[model samples]
Each structure stands twice: as C-alpha cells, then as structure tokens.
Target: MNSEQRKFEIWRHKMVARQIVARGITDPGVIAAMETVPRHLFVSEALTDSAYGDFPLPIGEAQTISQPYIIAEMTQALELTGDERVLEIGTGSGYQAAVLAEIVFRVYTIERNNILFLRTRKLFDALKYHNIVARYSDGTLGWKEEAPFDAILVTAGGTQIPQPLLDQLAVGGRLVMPVGGLCSQELVRIEKKADKITTDNLGGCRFVKLIGEHGWKE
Candidate 1:
C-alpha cells in the first residue's frame, strides 16, 4: 500500500482497538468489518482526515456519519453470524451500511434525502459494494417488498420504533435504533421472538430525526 493508504490503515486499526474493543464490543465480525471498510472514503474530501476519529462527521443534507463506536455498537447488537439479509433504515453517508456489508450476506438501505441517496449510491458502486442495495424513499415505511429481514438497523432517531420495521423483522431477528424525541434518544434493540417481542435499551444516543409517514412529519 501507498503511504497515505498505510496511514489510514493504522488509524483504522487504532479506531477498532481503542474506540470499539475498549468500549466492550466483542464481536469479531464487527471488529473485522470496522477495520476493513475505508471510512475516509465515506466523508467529504475536506473531512476525510477526521473520518477515523471517534466522532461523527457531516456528510451533507443535514446528515452525519455515526461515530465508529456507535456504529460498532449497533452492528454488534445485531448478533450477525454472516450470511443473513440485513435492512438498514437511513443510508446516511453509507458508512454504516458499508460496515454491515462487510459482515452480512446483503444489505438493503433506504435514504429519505434524494441528494444523500444519490451520493451514497455512487459511493457504494465505486467501492464495488455489490451486496448493498440502496433506495431513495421513506425509510420509516420499511422495505415491504423485501420484508422479513434477518436484521434491521435504523440510523436516525424517531419518536418510537416504526411499526413497519418491527413487522418486517423476521422471527428471532434483532432491530436496533435510537428512539425518543428529536434532540436526544435512547438506543434500543428489539428482538422478534416466536411468541412475543422483547425490547432492550442499549443506552442513550443522539441522531438526526427520522422523517417519514411512520416517523416524524417532515
């Protein structure tokens, strides 16, 4: 690898170690995915230097790529063993979905902002992430055509878990998202069991508002 590539590789490893592993993320697949994905390519040119930092960065359209730890946390919460169809609600910078793509069979992500949708789609294509399928639409409604996802991840915060997402989750699947008011929210993981559904609060988190028919009104 070239010098610049080597530098980013070192930074990526540090992010996986200090930010992810130190924070108690134990999923080997999640860690491997975090290290493999080129986070710098997911941000604007000006913000590329800070892509591996332990924080979020603006990716235009009022959206931000989530922090590495949070991404790792949410991904690990899915308990993926690979080879499962995943659904992501909010493509954002496409960073989260890329990370998922590295460890899952396939990822279907939706973005409400047309600009972000188009931009991220190009990025995914250029990176040769063929396993990631993206669409521009209301993510809150979920992808009914591809219903019964093995796992679902919502990148934005809503007043509550969108019912469509819950309905689309397959039995024994896990769905993680931030739910609460617009300003701040709590990270929750929903497990669709055979008989009943259970919710677990991962902790507090803040994300951009999820706007759609089932989410906050735009």
Candidate 2:
C-alpha cells in the first residue's frame, strides 16, 4: 500500500476498528464505511491524535464528533442498502456525513452552528465528497426542500421525536435518534410504513441537546 493509505489503515485498526467495531458493530457495510472514511480529517488538527479513538472528542463550538461506535451502530440500525437518500440532522464535524457519503446515494446534512457548517463544508470540499449537501439550519425542523428522505439520523438528544422529521421521512423509511431529557436519553429507531409508525428502543446514550422548534426548548 502507498504511504497515506498505510497510515490510514494503522489509524483505523489501532484507534477505531478493533476496539469500536469488533465490540458491537456487526454490520459489514458500517464497518467498511467507517474504515474508509478518514476520521482524523474531520476534527481540529490539535485533536488529530484522538480522532480515531472510540470516544467522542470536542470539535469546538460546544459540539463534538460522535463516537465511532455510536456512528457505526446508528448506521447499521438504519439497514441502508447504499441506494437511499439519507438525511443527517446534526453535522457537528461533518464526519458522519462523510461516512454516509461513502455508502448512500446522497446525504443531506444540517448543522445549527454556522461555524461548524462552514468548517464542515470546507472538509467536504477538500475530501471531494460531492454527494453530500451541507446546510446551516435548525436540525429539528428538518430540510423541507429535501423532504421524504429514505433515512434520517439525528445526532442529538430530544425529549420526543421531532414531528417535522417524522413527516419528512418517506414511507418505509427509518429514523434513528436519541430521545429523552438532557441527562437521560435512549437511542430510538422509528420506522414508518404506509400510514403507521413503529418505534423501538435500541439502547441508552448521552448526547448534547437538540435545540429547535420541535425539539427541546433552549
């Protein structure tokens, strides 16, 4: 392998793959996507060393790049087939969007923080991820122009599922999010089929609050 490729492999294995993926992420597609995306490039240069670690790292602006395991787990839970249009509610560092770009047909990511939105757009450009469209907006509102997404992933915590997001999900689509109060949250997977919506609690997780009209009051 070439120098850069070799370096990425080492980083993935030692910092992300072995500890994160092997522990609970069973989906091959999720594993492959995470392995190929350069997580280090998504964070600040000062925290590059911890880029591939299993835990979340600060990315400034009171945000963090979600942990690799959580990313993989959420992606796997969606049961994506690589042909669906995915909507990401939080584009903290654009790392999740980059990973989704590797597997989905198109990725529409929304970031509430303007600084993170600009920084992530630059990262997407630098990495040549043309499939991802980044926007600075309230994530809880969902992207109305890009409604009827095949899959929606929310990266923050809320007391309840945002109704706008549920409305935006196409029939037979899936939405994964962490739902509950600030200190207590459970990862939930909502599936919409025809006119009915089914909900399943995956597990508990802690995440920053999702602030918006249909989300937590801020």
Candidate 3:
C-alpha cells in the first residue's frame, strides 16, 4: 500500500484492537469489515486525521458518521453470514452501509437529508460498492418495498423502533438500533424468530436524531 493507505491501515488496526475488540466486540466478520472500509474516505478531508479516532465526526446536515466502535458493535449485533440482505437507515456518510456491504450480499440504505443522500450515493458508486443501494427518502419509515431483510441497522437514535421496521424483519432476522429519548439512547437488538420477537440491550449510545414521518420532526 502507498504511504497514506499504509497509515490508515495502522490506524485501523489500533482502532479495532483498542476501541472495538477491547470493548468485547469479537465477531470476525464485523471486525473484518471495519478494517476493510477506509473510514477516512467516508468523512470530509478536513476531518481525515480524526476518522479513526475514538469519536464520531460531523458529516454536515447535522449528521455524524458514527464512531468506529459503535459501528462494530451494531454490525456484530446483526450477525450477518455473507449471504443475507441488509437494510440500513441513516446513510450519513454511507460508511455504515459500506461496512455492511463488505460482509453481506446486499444493503438497502436510506437518508432523510437530501444533501447527504445525494453525496453518499455518488461516493458509493466511486467506491464501487455495487451491492449497496442508496435511497433518498425517510429512513425512519424503513424501506418497505424491500421488506424481509435478513438484517437491519438504524444508525440514528430514535424514541422508539418503528413498527414498520419490526414488521418487515424476516423470520430469524435481527434489527439493531438505539432506542430511548431525544438525546441519549440504549443500543438494542430485536430478533424475530418463528413469530416471536425477542429484544436485548447492547448498552448506551448517542446519535443524530432520526428524523422523518415516523421519527423526530424536522
């Protein structure tokens, strides 16, 4: 790798080890995807140095690219097997979807902010992530036409997991999101199995408010 790519690689290794694995995220595929996708490329040039740092970076439109550890945590919760279709809400920098695409067959991602939606779609194309489908719409509503996803991730924090999202989950599928009040939330995982839905908490996190018809008001 060239000098810049080499530096990024080193940072990623450090990031995965200290921020992710050290925190108990041990899923092989999730770790691989986090190491593969260049987080620096997903943020603005001015913030490249902080891309692999321990915090989230603003990507404009009041949205933020999630921290590396949270990304790893949420993806690990999905438990992708390299063949499942995944749906992602809040395509901020398209980083999360790119990471997911690396480990899953297909990713359907949506964003409410038009600017971010358009920019991220072009970035996905330039990155040659052909398996990631970007949509400019209300992410909180979920992608209904592409229902029955094997895994779904909502990047932004919302007051409640939208009913439509829960309904669209395929049997034995997993949906991960931050569920709580307007500001802070607890990372949660909901699993659908044989008509029974089970839920668990993966600890706490904060995210840009998920805004749309079913989420916080614009």
Highest TM-score model number: 1
lDDT of 1 by residue, 107-200 (tens): 9999989999999999999999999999999999999999999999999999899889999999999999999997899999999999999999
What's model 2's overall lDDT?
A: 0.89
Quote the positional error of residue 199 for candidate 2 in Å.
1.0
lDDT by residue (132-181, candidate 3, tens digit) is 99898888778889898898999988898988898889999999999988
In model 1, where do residues sit more than 4 Å from their true spots? none
Query: In model 2, what are the clashing residue pairs, if there are any?
Result: none
Q: Lowest-scoring 10 consecutive residues by lDDT in candidate 2?
A: 13-22
Better of 2 and 3 by lDDT: 3
The TM-scores of all predictions, comma-separated, are 0.99, 0.95, 0.97
The per-model lDDT (C-alpha) reads 0.95, 0.89, 0.90
Say what the RMSD of model 2 is: 1.5
Better of 1 and 2 by lDDT: 1
Judged by lDDT against the true structure, how good is candidate 3?
A: 0.90
lDDT of 2 by residue, 111-164 (tens): 988999999999899999999999989999999998999999999999999889
